[model samples]
Target: MKNLFLLLLFVGYSQAASACDCLMTPVRQHIKSTPYLLKGKVIAVLDDKNKEGRDYHLFLRSIGIQDTVSRGYSVKIIVQQDFKGKYKAGKIIEIHSTYSNCDMLFSAGETYILFLHKAQGNLFPTYCSYSNILDGSPASIDLVQAIRTELKSRD
Candidate 1:
């Protein structure tokens, strides 16, 4: 399996893929165990501050690589999202998210035109999180609105 994975990495940049699509699967993904994902066009690199206290290096890159093993070419940069860090404008980031942070913090499996880069910290990062609307849910959800609804009072 490891050799197969390495083979996929050898293939340099691939063709363009889904630019915007967030269809999440109910089946849980082993974020830590799976190799880090870094497939996307580094369109724009900027400084982003997540809900977490710390800051991060996020890139407005595109994503699209569902068939890594079959295609023999994966845009992914590292091994598993846990030990990988996405860079924005070429700079490592530090986040302060309070949610699940590791496993449930970052969204996985989707083509985000732009998303925050996640990493654990090192020569490379180790983060595995993707954003996918809950099944039968809208393509996008206003997290702030969700928070307000949860905090709103009932008559």
Candidate 2:
């Protein structure tokens, strides 16, 4: 029983670690950019959208970073999932996408990722991973959980 428990723990950790590594580096540093990149620790999770099915924000914290300078590189990451309506806030998940728009403060010319820790007010939940996205993490396909699929821009 002990051995089996340890094995499961190892596998789960290994998967998370790999996921984190996947989104730890900047885009310029890599030769080929993968779709999923960001990975981080979950801080909080909450839905900042109203019933109008218009507003949606997912907040997350950085689990891949060594130290958080200020707000832990908190970002309003965007999710692009066909079945986004199924996901709920506070579900510490991983994201697989590129930084479409950035404040240029933390990530400017880099292709990093953010892990889903918790949901912030409007930002939802996000963790800016300047490294690799967590391995065996939630499908990197969904960028951000949006109530609506059609949109002009995303963070």
lDDT, each prediction: 0.29, 0.31
Best by lDDT: 2
The true-versus-predicted C-alpha distance at residue 102 of model 1, in Å, is 18
lDDT of 2 at 126: 34
> What are the per-residue Cα lDDT tens digits for candidate 1 across 8-87?
66533332232323454321232323333222222222222542212221121212333222211112221222222344
Instruction: Estimate, for each residue in 1-155, the C-alpha lDDT of model 2 and write its tens digit.
Output: 99999988876775465343224454233212222323334332222233211122112212222222222223333332212233343333432222212212223222223322233322322333323332344533343221112222221
User: Model 2 misses residue 29 by how many Å?
Assistant: 29
RMSD of 2: 16.9
The list of candidate 1 runs beyond 4 A from truth reads 1-24, 27-129, 132-137, 142-155
Mark the regions of model 2 whose C-alpha exceeds 4 Å error after superposition: 1-69, 82-115, 119-155
lDDT score at residue 144, model 1, on the 0-100 scale? 23
